[model samples]
Target: MKKIAAFLLSIGPGLFCIGYTVGTGSVTSMAKAGSQYGSQLLWVLALSCIFSWALMEAYGRYAVVTGRTAVNSFKTELKFGKVLAVVLIVGIVIGQWNSLSGIVGLSANALYEIARLFLPGLPAESYWAVLSIAVVILAILYFLLIVGKYSFFEKILILFVTIMGVSFLISMFIVLPPPGEIAMGFIPSIPEGEGGSLLVAAFVGTTMAAPTFVVRPLLMQGKGWAREHTSLQSRDALSSALLMFVISASIMVTAMGALYYKGLTINKVIDMVYTLEPVAGKFAVALFMTGALSAGLSSVFPILMVAPLLISDYKNGELDLKSKLFKRLTAVACVVGLSVPILGANPIAAQIATQVANVFVLPLVIGGIIYMVNRKAVMGEHRAGWLLNTGLVLAFIFSCVISVIGFTALKDFF
Candidate 1:
C-alpha cells in the first residue's frame, strides 16, 4: 500500500499534460489517420511526440531554475512580455473552451451510446440529450475544481489516464496491427490520398500545441519542484509524452487493422466505436469507448486549469486552487467550454475547430519560448544548451510551416 501510494504521489505536471494532449482531438485525428492510411502516418505521431517532450522539458526546466512561470517570466524580462502574456492568456482561454466543448460533446456521444445498451428507448439522434449530458459533466467538473484538493485533482486525472491507457492497449492487442507495416511507418513517407496532407499537418499541430508549454510552468510551480528536480522533471515529461505516443499510435493501429482495408472511413469521432464493434466484438467496442470517455473526461480538468493558471500568472496573485475568485473564474470558463455543445455543435465541426484551428497560434508561442530560454538575465546558469536551442528553432520553423499548411487546408475546406 505504501509503495502504491508513493507511485501515485510521484505523478505531476507530465501526467497532467498527457491528460490534456490525448483528448478527443487526438483520438479523432489518430484514428482517422490510421483508418485512412494504415500505419503510414505513424512517423508524424512519432515526430510530434518528440517535439512535445523537448519543448515541455525546456519549459519546465525554465520554471524550476528561475522559479517563475512562463507568463511571469514574460511579464518581467522583456519589452513586449506583457503583450505576449496577454495574448497567450486570451488565446488559450478561447482555444481551450472550444476544446473542452468538443471533448464533452464527444464523450457524451459515447456515453449516450452506452446508455442505449440498457435503456432501449433512448433517443440516439437527440442533440439536446448530448447537450444535457455535457452540461451535467461540466457542472460536476466545475464543482470538483472549486472544492477538491489539488492533490485529489491530480490523482483523478492520473486515474483517468490509467483507465485510458489500459483500455486502449487492450483494444489494440485485440485488433493486432501487422508488425511489418507498423515498422515501415517509422521510415517517414507522405501518405497519398484526398485528406492525407491535411491529416498529417493536423496531427503535428494538435500534438505539439503551444498551450502545453504555456501550462507547464504553472504545473511545475504548483508542484513545488525546484532546479534540483530537473532530471526527475525531464523523466516525467519524456515518460508522459512517450506514453501519449503509444496510446495515440494504438488508436491508429486499431483503426488500421479493423477498419482501413475494409474500406470504411471514420466520418465522426464516435464512428470508431461502431467500426470496432463489427470487427473486434462488442467487448472491444465497450473497452474502446471506456478509454475514449476517460480520455475526454481527463482533458476537462486540464482544459479548465489552463486559463485560470494563466490568469493567476498574469496577475501575480494568489495560487489558491479553491479561492472564491478562482471558483468564479473556473465557473465562467466552464460556461465557455459548454457554449458550443449546448448550442448543438456538430462533433466533426468541433473536432476540426478545436484540433486544427487553434494551431495557427503555435508559431508565436514557440518563438516566445525560444526568446525567453536564451536570455541570460532570466536563465542565468541554467540557460538552454545548444542542442535545446536547435530543437526549439526546428520546432518553431516546423510549427510555422505546419500552421501555414493547416490554414491552407481550412481555406480549401471553405
Candidate 2:
C-alpha cells in the first residue's frame, strides 16, 4: 500500500501529459473512427500511442539529464533552431487555438444538454446558449488560473482526468462491446474504402498530439523531478501511456458497440448524446456527457496555458503563469478558443486540421530531437539506446507518410 501510494505521489509530468492528450479531440476522433469502421483501426491507436510514449520518454530523459527543455535544445543546439521554433510555435498557436475551440464548444454543448434536463424552459437548442455557458466556464477557468497555485491547478487536472476516465469506462461497460470483434482489432489493417486511410492517419496523429511533447519538459520541471528520477520518469510515462490507450480504447469500443452498425454519421461531438442511447440506455447519455465535459475542461485548461508555456520557452523566460502578461496572453487565447463554437466552426473539422498540422510538423521535430539526443556532447552516457533509436527512426518515417496522406487528402483546401 505504501509502495502504491509512493508511486502515485511520484507521478506528475506524465499524468499531466495524459490530461491534455485525452481531450475532446481524442474522444471525437476515436468515436468517429469506431463508428465508421468499427474496431479495425485500433491498431493505429495502439501504434500511435507507442510512438507517443517513445517520444515522451525521450523528451523526459533529455529534460532530466541535460536540464534543457525542447525549445531551449532547439535554440542552442541546432543552427536553424530559432527559425524552427518560430515556425513550430506558429503551428502550436494555430493548432491549440482550434483544439481549445473544439473543447470549449463541445463541453458547453454538453452542459447545455444537461441544463435542459433541469430547466426545460431554457433554450437548449440555441448555439448562443451553449456559447454563453462556454463564456462563463472560460471566465471561471481564467480566474482560477490567475488566483490558483500550480499545485491547485495540477489537482484540478488530475480530478478532471479521473472523472473522465471512470465515467467513460462506466459507459463502456453499459454499452458492452463484443469481445471477439474487439480482439481482432489487435491485427493492423486499413479498412476498404476512401475514408479508411484518412481515419487511420487521424487515429495515429490525434492519439498523442504535438503539444504534449512541448509541455512535457515544463511539466517535469514543475514536478521537481530530477536526474535521479529517471527511472520514475519511465514508469510514469509507461503508466500514463497505457492509461491513455485504455481510455481511448474504451471510447472507441463504446462508439463501436452503439453507433457503428446503425449507419449513423457523427459530425459533431454532441451527436453522441443521441447516438449512445440505444446501446447504453438513456442514463448513459449523462455518463457520456460527464466524461466529455471532463475531457473538454481538462483540455481547455492546458491549452490556455500552452501559449504562455511555449512563449516562455522561445524567449527563455520563467514559466510564471501568475505574471500579468502571461495571464493576459492566456485570456486572449481563451477568447480565441471560444470563438470557434460561437462562430459555428465544426469541432471535428477543427480537430482534423490541428491533427494534420501535427503530422506535418512531426518529422521536423522528431528529426531535430533525433540529432540532439544522439550527440555524445549533449547526452553523454544518457543517450538513447539502439532500441529507442530504432523506434524513433521508424516513428519519423511513419509520421512523414501520415503527413503525406493528410496533405494529399486536403490538397483542395490548400
Candidate 3:
C-alpha cells in the first residue's frame, strides 16, 4: 500500500495529464470510432499516444532545464516570440473553453442518464434538469478551484483518473472483444465513410492534445521540479502516455464488443447508456456512465484552468491561484461551460467539433516546442537530441495531415 501510494505521488503531473487527456472528448471519440469502425482506427490512437509522450518530454524537459513554461519559452526563445505566444494563448483558450461547454454538457447528461436509470418517470428530454445538473456540478468544481490549492486539485484528479481507468477497464473486460480483431486494429487502415476523416482527426486531436503539452510544463513548474528531475519527467511522460493508451483502448474495445458486434451506434452521451444496458446489462451501463462522468469531471478542472494558466504562462510562467485574475477568469470559464446545456446543444457533436478544431493549432504547438527545445540559448546543454527532434518532426507532419483532414471533414458539417 505504501509503495502504491508513493508511486501515485511520484507521477502526480502525469496523472493530471491523464485526467486532462482522457476526458469526455476522448471517451466520445473512442466510443464513436469503435461503434462505427470496430477497432479499425486503433492505429491512430496508438500513434497519437506515442507522439503525445514525445511532445510532453520536449515540453517538460524544456521547463525543467530552463525553468520556463511553454508559453514563456515561446515568448523568450523564438523569433517573433511575443506574437506567437499571444496567438497560442488566444487559440488554445478559445478551443479549451469551447471544449468545456461540451464537457459540462456531457457530464450533466450522463448524470441524468444514471438518475433516470433509477427513476424511470423522469422526463425523457428535460433540458432544465440537465442544465440544473450542469449548474450544480460546475458550482461545486468552481468552489473547489477557489478554495483548493494545486496539490489538493491534483489529488482530486488522481481519484477521478483512477475511477475512469478502473470503470472502463472492468467494463471492457465484461464485453471483451476478440484478441485477433484487437490485434488487427494496430495494422493502420483508415475507415472509409462520411465521418471517417473527422473521427481520425478528432482521435489525434484529443489524444496528442496541444493543451496537454502546453499545460504540462506549467504543471511541472507547479510541482517545483527542476533540472535534476528530467529523468523523472521522462518516466512520467511515458507512464502518462501508456495509461492514456490503455484507458482509451479499453473504451474503444468495449464499444467494439458491445455495440459494433450488436449493430448499434452511439449518437449522443446518453446513447452509450441506453445501448449498453440491454446488451451488457444494467451494471455495465452504470459502470460506463460512472466512467464517463469521471472523465467529464476530471477534465473540467484543467479546462477551466487553461485560459488563466496560459495567460499566466505568457506573463511570468508562474501559477497564482490566489490572484483575482485567476478567480475571474475561472468564473468566466464556468459560466461559458454552461452554454451547451442551456442552449440544448448536442454534447457529443459539440465535443467532436471542438476536438476537430483543436487540430488546427497542433502544427504551431509542435513547431513552437521543437524550436524552443532545440535552441542552445534557452536549453543550453540540455537541448533536445536528434531522436526527440525526429519524433517531433513526425508529430508535426502528422499534425499537418490531420489538419487537412479536419478541414475537409468540417466542410461536411456545414
lDDT of 2: 0.79
Clash pairs of candidate 1? none
Find the candidate with the highest TM-score and give its number: 3
Per-residue CA lDDT of model 3 for 159-259, tens digit only, reads: 89989999999999999988999999999888896888899999987998788999998889889899999999999999999999999999999999989
Prediction-by-prediction clash tally: 0, 0, 0
Assess each prediction's global lDDT (C-alpha) against the native.
Answer: 0.80, 0.79, 0.90
lDDT winner between candidates 2 and 3: 3
Residue-level lDDT of model 1, residues 252-310, one tens digit each, is 89888889889887887557766787788778888888888898888888888777677
Error of 3 at 120 (Å): 1.9
Give every collision pair in model 2. none
Q: Measured by TM-score, how close is model 3 to the native structure?
A: 0.98
Which window of ten consecutive residues has the lowest lDDT sum in model 2? Answer: 4-13
lDDT of 3 at 228: 98
Ranked candidates (TM-score, high to low): 3, 1, 2
